[model samples]
Target chain A: MTGKLAWTKIALPLGVAALLLLAWDAAVRVSGSDIFPRPHEVLRGIIQLIEQGLLLKYVVASLFRVTWGFTLAVLIGVPFGLFLGWYGWAFQAFNPMIQMLRPISPIAWIPVAILWFKVTDKAPIFLIFLASVFPIAVSAIAAVQNMQPVYLRAARNFGLTQLQLFRRVILPATLPQIITGIRIALGVAWLVVVAAEMIAVNSGLGYLIIDARNAGKRYDLVVAGMVMIGLIGLVLDLLVRQLEKFDEVRWGYANR
Target chain B: MQANPTVQVRDLWMSFPGKRSGEQVHVLERINFEVRQGEFVCIVGPSGCGKSTLLNIIGGFLRGSRGDVMVEGQPVAGPDPRRIFVFQENGVFPWLTVTENIGFGLLKKSEPERAKIVAHYIEMVGLNGFERAYPRELSGGMKQRVEIARALAANPDIIYMDEPFGALDFITRLKMRADLVRIWQSEKKTILFVTHDIEEAVQLSDRVLVMSKRPATIQTIVSIDLPRPRDLDSAGYLETRDRIFSAMGMSLRIGENEKEALPISAQQPV
Candidate 1:
């Protein structure tokens, strides 16, 4: 019953989007503009990219960079976040360093990433990691610092050991915040991937964009690549939303 | 020296490190109190007083800078399952169902025993039909009953509640007060409850310990001396309630004051 109530609101918008897709295809055919290719042509372009193995390589390259960078960032960022959130001294130690450098873009890090890592794949990964790390660190810290002290008390009273408290109560309690950080960090990850790929990497959707623009072969292909990036991003966001929903069900708003 | 209470608090002191300034600020001092076996001691004071702090110290949720609290004549160094606590904000874990929460303490018991205990408390709290219901689905009074049942299922000798009903509306709060009194009288568990409301302290407790402002010292402790199933309209209830308020630096203006004592009765409905 509750599920029906939640899903009922989606019916109208979904129908509208389906209707718009039909309208867009018809309008493109009727206009007869060389520039306004049909949506089917874009769909065929997507299939051609896939069949030529070009799309796969770029997708693989982008995924590899994103996955490794995100993993490393989590490895480095979570500890920093947990530490910062746990104590006053941790923040005092890292705040100035993090804040001073935080505002600098991931694109800015591209030159440094290339210089520091010397143009290897590590360079782009490093930039992506840099982009993703801070939000996770900051949010993790915020989550832990803001945690309602009640959960701690509840845990202690329930025979949770110090380790158990951190694992069960503290870690789980900070997860919603950590998830928020991860979600925000994902945007940075995607942004860094495009920028990093454009300058340093030999292949990726970013590379495809720049390469196509230089060739002037098809702006639609460039748009197609951009759309694919956006579509993947939407999936990532939805994945995070689902995870956060599960966490919220397990705890209440993660309280901090 | 007073035959050590089931729960004894001696000269408990706690102070806060003032935020932003790192200044030392005393919150409670010179606090001496005890809760005998099955005793109901209510502590009341003005807002900012350390009533909750004192309760937390006794519960071992917070450490007191001075003195100690003994439960069963053993110094309480940390939280113990044998001593349960119910707080004003929802203490029931949101993830757990009514049955799961009531059975929270029964984890130490054998599986069958745990089930039996859970079943008993569900019936006792009149929550049998709603065993699988999550706390978010229940009304406030129902949630409080589950906590009360949860504590009872643990068979804890004492319950340290810090304004368990303070968040509820007046009607709900009144109903909860009645239900709590009924539960306490039947179970006869020691309860050290903290509140800022004098009437609540008076209606529910055998004794009310009123604390002064921050660096809170126990200004006074009033034994309600009112009988079970206390009549809200009776003179004895009004007198005790007024005394607690006057100690709290306010007199009752909303409710009429009484000067005559009503017949006291110990008979309680099952």
Candidate 2:
């Protein structure tokens, strides 16, 4: 029974996807449109890109920018957030500016990124970094602020120094929330990289879509790029979710 | 009075600022008490009578507005490793397993020593099979046991409990009380426990301190002269329990009229 239930969990989603593809094919055939590509055509386009090695190259390029941008965001954002969360005066001084900047779209930073980095890889990388850092920092700050007072009391009763308290209690207690923030920031980073590449860079999935359309109206390749982006985003989310399985952080999540 | 006092509170007063400016809300008043070495003392009072606040003050989590709390002859300036507090709420670190939580304060010890101590406490708490289970996986009573074990493993001279079993079910609380008595007998740690349950106070402590309502003061201190494995239905137990109930101005018998039983505010229309 368990095996059957598991099979249905996977099979049901795949079945819906198959139905959607068939509907798309029917719509195209019934309309008799020449410009729009069929599902098979998109599949063929992906296979063609694979043969030409552009699929791997473009994927690697997009991933490379996202990796660097997201890494930088985590490294800088977490510690800055911890500081803000720890010191009341520091939060007071910096919070208004963070709140003010947070709501503005990361896409709004595209112009500044281009002006600063001049159409290089850094432009898109900077935009991805901009998109991701705020959520990560804000989540960390909230996590620290919302920590249980009993834990702090317990730590103090143990005679832990301030630094030891942070290392042992504060960090571990807040980590589950921080990991959630990292997951959200990664999604935003993936989104911003695609947007950034469409405007500023020359060789990623986003660029492939724009280039395919402008060069020869290759809608098949465009659709394939979108599919690849969706697949990769799902993969990235899955990877980050694995962090929640750790024994030290599992309590933060609800049991299945 | 045979043993030296392990804890002393001299004229402790606590007050917090009221919502209105220049106004103070007195929570505790002239709180004076002492727990002799290896004695189990329980503080019983009405809800919001500031019994927990008094415990916190002595535990060094909060400061009294006036007076001093001395433990083992040293004034409590702040929380010390030698005195551990088991909170009313679940205080076990959710992120840590039973073993890790029990070993939390043993960070200074050698790895082997810490492991041995953690293992011993885990066994003592009857959590032998759950050594690797996180607190979230345990029931309320089990989690409280983990907390008690954690406090004992630290080798604290005194354990301050603020209604530690208040959250457990009746059966679980009874079992916990029995197990706690067993542990206290073996460990011989001086304990100061606060609870609103008169029966519980009578069951666990060598002395029970009853407190008055807000701006609270120790109204009376009744010493329990019963032996270990006390019989709850015994005439002596009932008599002592009745005395505490009367001291708190409560009657065991329900009033004949329901309306007369309730306060005026509770009698008002919704």
Candidate 3:
């Protein structure tokens, strides 16, 4: 019974995907659009990229930028957010500025990024950081603000020092929410990295799409790049979600 | 048995700022009580009667608007490790295993000492074989046990519980009360418990302090002189419970002469 259930779980999504691919192939054939590639043509395009050794290089380049940018946001945004959350005065003073910056899209910063970094990988990396940092920081702040007051009271009753309270009580209590924030920030980072790559950088999946269209109108390769981005984004999300499985933070999540 | 008092409150008063500016809403008014060393005292009152406010003041989590609160002849400047407060809500660290939570206050102790103490309390609280379980894995009663164990493991001179078992089911609450009495007998720690349940107040306390309604004051302090594991059906138990009920201006019989409720002053223990 267990085996059959697991089989169905895998089979259901695959069945839907297969149907979608068939529909796409039929649409391409009936339309007879020379530029629009069929599903098999996109598959061949992916194989072609792999055979040319460009697939691994491009995928690695995109992932590297996302990693650096997302990691930087986590390192800086989390502590800053925690500080603001802990100190009401700090939040009051800085919240306006954060609120102002948070609404401006990372794509809106592309011109500024180019002017500062000048066609380097840093330009896209900077954009990714800008996109992801606010979500992470805001989530952390909300986590701390919404924490159970009873925990703080209990911690104080135990005579924990301020530093110890932050490290032991505040940090652990807010972790589940902070992790959720990080997951959202990662998604934003992935999105901004692609947009940044399209304009500012000469490598990665985003560049692959633009270069295919500009250089040869290889719609098949463009679709292949798009597919790769979607797949990689899914994998990154799945990896970060695994953090919620830890015993300490598991209480924050609902039981399935 | 009249040893030195562990906690003494002198004409304590507490009030919060009203919704409108420059107005005050009094909670506790001229509240005075003394808890002897190793005594189990329960403060019972109406739902909003400031029993919890009194407990919080004694616990040093909140300062009274007026009056002095002394613990072991020293003023309660703030929450000290020597005294712990158990909240009505589940306060066990969700991230921590049972062992870690119980050992939370033992950060200054050596690893071996902490482990030994945690293990001892786990056994005492009847949480054996569940050392690795987190708060989420435990039942309500078991979680309360973890909290009580945590408070005890801290080795405090006093434990102030604000309706610690108020959220538990009927059977679990009864079992917890018996277990708590057994633990109190063995440990002999001073406890200042606040609850609205008259039966619970009577069942657990050496003395039950009945408080009046908002801007609350101690209406009466009823001494429960019954033995441990006291019979609930006994005349003495029922009399004491009814006295507290009457002291709160409540009629013992349902839909009876509500007008015949005794005045608060008449119910005071001589």
Q: For residues B141-224, write the lDDT of model 1, one tens digit per residue.
A: 898888888878888878889888887899988888887888888887888888887788888888888888787898888887
Clash list (residue pairs), candidate 1 = A143-A256, B27-B215, B27-B216
Runs with alpha carbons beyond 4 Å of true place in candidate 1 = A1-44, A115-121, A247-256, B1-4, B11-29, B62-69, B103-113, B212-219, B243-250, B253-270
Q: Give the Å error, residue B3, model 3.
A: 2.0
What are the TM-scores, per candidate, against the unseen true structure?
0.80, 0.96, 0.97
lDDT of 2: 0.94
Two-way DockQ contest, 1 vs 2, winner: 2
Candidate 3 docking: what grade? high
Worst 10 residues of 3 chain B by lDDT: B255-264
Prediction RMSDs, each to the true structure: 7.4, 1.9, 4.0
Clashing pairs in 3: none
Q: Order the candidates by DockQ, highest first.
A: 2, 3, 1
lDDT of 3 by residue, A141-214 (tens): 99999999999999998888889999999999999999999999999999988888999999998999899999
lDDT on C-alpha atoms for all candidate structures: 0.81, 0.94, 0.93
Q: What DockQ results for candidate 2?
A: 0.86
Residues A45-95, model 2: lDDT tens digits: 999999999999999999999999999999999999989998999999999
**lDDT of each residue in B56-90, candidate 3, tens digit only:** 88888899999999999999999998998888997
Give the chain B TM-score for each candidate: 0.89, 0.95, 0.94
| Candidate 2 Cα deviation (angstroms), residue A205 | 0.5
